[model samples]
Target chain A: MIKKFTSALNLKSGHVDLSHGGGGRAMTQLIDELFIKHFDNDLLRQHNDQALFSVPAGRLAISTDGHVISPLFFPGGDIGSLAVHGTLNDVAMSGARPLYLAAGFILEEGLPLADLERIVISMAAASKAAGTPIVTGDTKVVERGKGDGVFITTTGVGIVPEGVNISGNRASPGCAILISGSIGDHGVAIMAGRENLQFETSIVSDSAALHGLVADLVAVAPAAIRCLRDPTRGGLATTLNELAKQSGVGMAIAEDRIPVKAQVKAACEILGLDPLYVANEGKLVCVCEASAAETLLAVMQQHPLGRDAAIIGEVIDDPHGFVQMATTFGGRRIVDWPVGEQLPRIC
Target chain B: MIKKFTSALNLKSGHVDLSHGGGGRAMTQLIDELFIKHFDNDLLRQHNDQALFSVPAGRLAISTDGHVISPLFFPGGDIGSLAVHGTLNDVAMSGARPLYLAAGFILEEGLPLADLERIVISMAAASKAAGTPIVTGDTKVVERGKGDGVFITTTGVGIVPEGVNISGNRASPGCAILISGSIGDHGVAIMAGRENLQFETSIVSDSAALHGLVADLVAVAPAAIRCLRDPTRGGLATTLNELAKQSGVGMAIAEDRIPVKAQVKAACEILGLDPLYVANEGKLVCVCEASAAETLLAVMQQHPLGRDAAIIGEVIDDPHGFVQMATTFGGRRIVDWPVGEQLPRIC
Candidate 1:
């Protein structure tokens, strides 16, 4: 990622200009000083246009995600960390162990050098924490008005172990649905940060890497687990509906069995939003055979990222794949697919 | 890339709305009717978050590129085709056969649906022409003011055949340098489009996928091909400087032996841009043993992309790693590392 710099950079108060991304000495210097000094991997150090490696013949999973979230920094995480976690989780959903990452950055001209460095450092830390190295990357700068501060896109490669065959369409008529921890944390945090909400809100995004917890679940019941998916973007209800439709079935659940933090519930109610539709970054939905649900719950509860794991619903036989929920008042309502204007750039 | 659409999209007379990227029914509908319809493949039709595939045990190369070029549409291509070519070229530089690609798109609200569809169709055509498939992808939207039209990022995965080992650092002091074709087509085309230069300029970008050409060269003489690199953003002079520095050697060339098209030369002369410093998307620089130069030149000239191949320079031993050019005049001048402001977002 870097080359040996001939001089030091003015990172303290420097701003990115057109020359920094012009593929000249200035761009090389920035990479040498900022990117190379931090990423510091053997593959990146080669300074080649591509990173080369050898892998054994096996089933490999590849996922890509683009993060264009507003308010680059938030209560619990920044765009840099979120970019890494988002792609990693996507690859992990296949019950695969992420091996490498490739990132591409689009920076707007005049962005503060300090802020860019902070994001890079945060991204490196997140990758390192998850034991995945960014082997290759590309950077481009746009005109001042053509872009926001910065947009990051990450692609992850993972190798699924033998005997693991997780996919969204594997959910059948009798499988049970389980979640790893609470919901609405990430959505509520982004809303509070964006709106300021006229008070000191205790909301923080639950944007943690869930591959480790997924590894645990896959290790315990490789075949019994039907599918795994992170409840992101449109949140738990939307994800459930997707799974049911993909598997050609329906779902029924008890509202009391689902888990939600008190603060998240309060914030959603105040904002006129339903908790079931809000996003959760660090949580996941797991579908498995009903016989193995208890064993899987025990395994999930033993992990740090999955203490609040619960069996929220069970698959049912319905041609329309409707997700019906039994409310606390003993009333039944269908959980329809989410519709309407999206919270733009919410990661 | 797509899901089943409940209804046809508002394609002919509509613009992209925020809901199209909101991870709801609207987003799915857009993807189903547009992206999926164009980029349909067996792996993509599976509808998994990640694409799973198996490969033979071998060395693999990966490259990532973000295309944020201005004037999204130009003479030879748009941002979509450029995105595919850019990354495929990067992987081809390693003497690898590109097999799969993953794409991420960031769309700005209010973008015309017709323009987006045009770009998507062009990208799908490019991918098909190159024999590589878009296996998995993602989409995110930013508010109108936060982005320009659209930016695309692509990552490529390729496998290197046995006995072909290429690296930037493989050039020795006694190696020879060669170029595939003429320079400055892409840079001149972009300049003419952006500045609306006076007179009818015949310049068109030479953006192309070079894996087929590269495979021919590697197949003929795998061991003699020491290093291969495409002169994209930095052009021929800057690319030579990078190779010299990486190989810890110097380079000397005769100006009369270099190849340049008549139209590109006239355009560069009028625009006050040096053809040697202008970018060329479809060109490449090869460094190999002095003994194999003629054979390699013959091999390159036999291919369509390398018909104008020429032996431009020879590597030399020097502590400073300078690239000296014997000019048309009687003097020798050093081609120093390019410094100063750059032409941003050219490719």
Candidate 2:
């Protein structure tokens, strides 16, 4: 017989006060409606203070991310869904099967209860869709004016299949570089939502979990794939530069080969930002042997999340560790790391 | 052969701007001097874009914590150490062997480089002592005034021994309760350090890792132990109340049996605060079978970190799940959950 300890809560129209984050009845209600509803699974349904589960035999990959972006509700998603996707993508970058997550929230005093519920619901939905459950969590409240609305920190655990030796340093010369989707969508979307940067057109953030796409790629070209990286905060340019430095190689690309949506490109130009440096939360950079590049690209394109996949560049042995792209005008220039953050509070 | 990457930074000491948190030379230097230097380990030295390590085969427990304590540096430890200890304790509470950690930093613009260095050193020391290393991390900087000086979020992963089942809901009727060391030391220590309090006393915050003591308890009384909890934010009274609610049981605690240091008790009395609601970073609450209570108490007292350990309470089946304490005057009163945060950022 199943015994339900906590009752369902009416989360709509509720405003979160200091008490909500205070580990009392208010917290229990929030967990029941917003967290448990979406992440509902046997492990979480147990209602124990901690989640207990067994891991199948394999190497494990664990990653954590904290989401404190201002304006809890953004164009694409709220802090809740972002928390699930951020850590899930982190584990997925290791070519692993993300299984479970632990979340800790530091909610500021006086945040509307409705907003918290909305965020939590979104998080639950995201976790459910991604096949990961938030089994254990903690809630803490900070004094009024001492914190932003709410900050969520998520820790994810995943299992990597045996014999999958993948790392940023594993990229070898002649490996093909492919991007899962268009660049700069997430950063531009967030900036557009900001009051100061309100633009004419709406641009939603490309925030998502990429484990499914990764699992598909690994199935087809496991040995050929050298590395996988989700181009986040610093974007594709910074990611490629880091990979170049790590692998002791250089990268050459044709500007025409990279995919950039028209709206994103125009937004970047208007804001004086390079599309390459802007973030891409849903997109991933995969480095694979040239022999298996087409197979991986085909698999990525078949997935709805990776429909805009493109073969962007190729790796080359270069001690200088340069990342260069050829312009449509037939000229070439070095793509250096961005001097500073392109957009702040972009996950 | 070993390689060294150290340089004298050109920027002035106290003038950090938006670019410092950018993933570039300044950020690299900040990580190299402040974070990497203190959190040095072979896994971090891999210098790959991510940290990779081997996990032993076993059940796993994972936890994450976001440290947003104001005045980044506190009485006994700063946000760095607090971040490490907070998550590590969460993992240890599951009766697991804590192994690795990942840290994320949200740095506000204009934070002094020197201060970051101090916090990083504290984190390094805490990790070294706990036998866990921060293997991977991400850093972001918010504009000045938009955020406090620094916020640290740490995530930890651990391996649970087979057949070890420890949880908050495991408390049963006739279970004995044990507390580690003096309570309210951390809360009072911070209160004394506050400029508004203006009370001068020699009460240092009890901010130490409890995994060592947990290992000791598990060694001698593994099967008898039901639950282990760190009395952190809402302190002993709140923690006991949570246990009671989770386990659907009532608790009877002796007020005189609960250990409180002279300084903490005096400070609480002077401030019109209850030491029961005050925080204690280094202390923990253990629940076990009543028959093995004496043996567990003896084992806890033998450890340096648990010298003041005492059996403070017992569990009873109750419909209302009340936590009542017997006063020294032979009167019994209900200890209710705290309504609001008594002292913010006391952790």
TM-score of each: 0.97, 0.94
Clashing pairs in 1: none
Evaluate all candidate structures by whole-model CA lDDT and list the values in order: 0.88, 0.80
Q: Indicate the TM-score of model 1.
A: 0.97
Every candidate's CA RMSD: 1.8, 2.8
Error of 1 at B283 (Å): 1.0
Cα lDDT tens digits for candidate 1, A117-227:
999899999999999888999888888988999999999998898899998888888899999988889988888888545445788999999899989989999999998
State which docking tier applies to candidate 2.
acceptable
Candidate 2: residue pairs that collide: A14-A113, A14-A114, A15-A113, A16-A112, A16-A113
Off by over 4 Å in 2: A1-14, A24-29, A41-50, B1-12, B47-50
Per-prediction DockQ, in order? 0.65, 0.42
Docking class of 1: medium
